[model samples]
Target: MDKIATVKWLDNLCLVGQTSSGHAVVMDGPPDIGGQNLGPRPMEMVLLGLGGCTAVDVIMMLQKSNQAVVDCHIEVSAERAETIPKVYTKIHVHYVVKGRELSEAKVARAVNLSSEKYCSVSKMLEQSAEVTHDFEIVELS
Candidate 1:
């Protein structure tokens, strides 16, 4: 574990994370919501983190399998409970893969590998929601 954040108030999570050069990511929550919003809403960031992680994994796997990846897109949708203890109940991930000579099996395998082994965010989110996925391949000009 690394250095942690101590909450001085509600909605506020301050962390003292250091860069390799000893610089810091001085993050804060929104002041109106008892933080600075400088670090972004935790939930929002979570979604992006998942997308980024899975995106990299997909790209890597496709490249290794020799797919000429022109571009990739991931869309994430989540349903959250509207209550005090809000949590996601369902989530759907759609992957749009644009390339040349793309194999559906290879794309499926890449997605599976990311969700099963590489993406930590997806694994954690799975505990809360029934995560589902689908993919489409688009040939380029």
Candidate 2:
């Protein structure tokens, strides 16, 4: 599938971009970079994308496994290279999963599968960054 987006410069260091799916996002650099802190930085969007990608996979895998998952949250952290062409060097995805009778093995397996096999974002980021994951299961009565 081919995806596309258009980024329109809104102001100094600020831009508004829209995806082929018609979803819009605002981006800007830090104040030091001439941005007024209008929205998320472009690099920060990458982290958000990664989180969204893996969260979807984990939820889908749990559903397919007949796991009763009520909620799922992911915290993504990363370290970026300090030099030019700055890129992510290391990344971590921490998942908080909630449900009833949520099997520990299933949760781990789902996260592993997403990180190792299913999540395209994870796979792509792993090419440049060391991606790691940890998950916690919260049971609800």
TM-score per model over all chains: 0.75, 0.95
| Tens-place lDDT digits, model 1, residues 1-141 | 765444233334644444456554445666776666666555665687788889999999999999999999999888888985788888888899999889999999999899888888899999988888888999887
Q: How many clashing residue pairs appear in each of the predictions shown?
A: 7, 0
Error of 2 at 30 (Å): 1.4
Candidate 2, 121: how far from true, in Å? 0.9
Give, for candidate 2, the lowest lDDT window spanning 10 residues.
1-10
lDDT of 2: 0.95
Candidate 2 lDDT, tens digit per residue, 1-141? 676998999889999999999999999989997999989999999999999999999999999999999999999999999998899999999999999999999999999999999999899999999999999999999
- Steric clash pairs (candidate 2): none
Query: In angstroms, how far off is 72's CA in candidate 2?
Result: 0.5
lDDT scores in order: 0.80, 0.95
